[model samples]
Target: MRRRVPNEVGIAAVVVLVAIVLSVLSPNFRTIENAQVLLLNGAVIAFLALGQTFVLLTGGIDLSTGSNIALTGMIAALATSAGLPWYVAVIAAIAIGLVVGSLNGSLIAYLKLPPFIVTFATFGVAASIPLILTGASSVNVRDPFFAIIGRGALFGIPMPVVLVAVAAIVFSVVLRFTSTGVHIYAVGGNAETSRLAGVRSARVIVLAYALSGLCAAMGGLIVTSRLMVGYPSAGSGNELFYSIAAAVVGGVSLFGGIGSIGGALLGAMLIATVSNGMNVIGVESYWQPLVIGVIILVGVVLDTHRRRISLATLLSRFRGPREAAAAAPTS
Candidate 1:
């Protein structure tokens, strides 16, 4: 009987390979400053990736992350502009995220709607938030406190990067050591089985989306702080890439019940590397999307192969069990 493929190992190898290739392609890609920039650029998406890890763990996807980023960023900026304390503005932004997440969860959990459709509808509304709030204008956040909160670094690390690291640590602890994490994986792995085992499938499902919303909110805030301005189209169409990259790269099974936060971070970093390398090599902006699409396709293919290899191994292992039973333990 064959053994299950080591998906994590395979993915890590790919990440390493990509990094090496990019380093070879662009001499500066291996430098510390560029490395920081890559991570800085990916901070928001990394936040999205981390949050998406939760949702995906429960066998779900979130399309509204980009939109949520837009909404929260603008809202926070406006709050800061209104003389709100920096901390207060941050809290308000988180509240907005909670509301948006709760709304998404409530509809799906209580109302029994499909997550994709619900998120899609919310995605549309969220995509319009900056426009609704600012009439398609950019809102600048000039509060020194606010700016420092996002742009400032501690011990030479970017604020957003530090936050992402913290979030990853927390999520890793939660997903690896908590009962809620088990329930989440169970619900995603098999809803019927999870319910039969007394897990609150509904709550888990809803909570997953809520967490996803918060992630997007965090991402938005980071981007806003970095840019110091909120654009209506700030996060337009970013959800697709963020979701796919994290899940595929992190070994978070699209089939659910399997993945690690560390893997998700690596996934985000890999995508960030690609974007950073392309820029360093002076690839035209227009071709960036094309490259992203191809990379995504490669991820998908890896996922496909991982699944096939795993299933084949499993089947091979089981084939002997049936054969043994049929042959009987006559010895």
Candidate 2:
């Protein structure tokens, strides 16, 4: 078998290549301000991608993330408009995610429903909820505190970027060092095996979904703060597609049991770079979807190949030196 580049390294190379190409194509793209914008833009998707990574790790998917964002953003906006404190609105928004995630976890864990179908159905229900509550109108957020979460800068870095970094650090620790993290991987790798080993598959699955929801809530809040408005269609379809794509591209396997938050962030950066570059270069809006689709297709193909390579490597290790000597010719 040919030597293969590590997933993160390959992705990082792609990021660098894309940045170079964009820099050449658009003189403005190389500026520090633009770099800041790229990071900020990527941060929102990165947040959702991180959550998706957790769910995907458990061999599950959360199709409602975007819808959850819409619902939570609307809740935050409405709360602030009703004279509630900004912090309180923020809490309320996150609560919406927790409730939705808990519901999804309960149904999937207890009822034995397919994760795909459960999340898919919830996507529809969650998307419609914001409209029901707001009568399909956009609610503007006038709170300065709410605005700061999106626009404020700390130590010369955007708030959104800082939050994303902090989240990545926390998740890295959780997934790498904690027993719950190991159990999550175990469940995704093989539920029966994990159960036999005394891991509570149901609770782990629930926790994964709950974390996904919390991430969605955080994403929605930042979006609302940035736009200074709570529109039911805010995250729209982008949340579901981008989050999953970023995670997958970052090295999170669709089949589950393998991936990292850092990888997902790199994936988000790649996608964000493409988007911002295309916009800066004045690519037609109609072609954007096609480009994103093609990139995702390529990423999926790469992931498949990576899996094959892993399997081959494992099988080769099992074929010991004695077997190899037996197969060799005596010259």
lDDT of 2 at 170: 97
Clashes of 1: 0
Q: For residues 1-331, could you state the per-residue lDDT of candidate 2 as single tens digits? A: 9986667998899999999999999999999988888887788899999999999999998998999999999999999999998999999999999889888888998899999999999999999999999899999886778988889889988999999999999999999999999999999998899999999999998999999999999999999999989999977855678888889989998888999888999999998898889988999877777878887788779878978998998888888776988999998
| Candidate 1 per-residue C-alpha lDDT over 1-331 given as tens digits, one digit per residue, 9 for 90 to 100 | 9996755676678778988988888889899988878878888778888888888788777778878888988888898888887777788888888788889888888898888899889989988877987889998885767876568999988888889889989888988899998999898878899999999988888788888888888877887888888767877854557656766676776767778888888888777777778889888867877877776677767767877887899998999889989899676
State the weakest 10-residue window (summed lDDT) of model 2.
234-243
After superposition, which runs of candidate 1 have C-alpha atoms over 4 Å from their true positions? 1-6, 237-239, 315-319, 329-331
Query: Can you list the residue pairs that collide in candidate 2?
Result: none
Clashes by residue pair, model 1: none
Highest lDDT against the true fold, candidate: 2
- Candidate 2 RMSD to the real structure: 3.0
Best by TM-score: 2
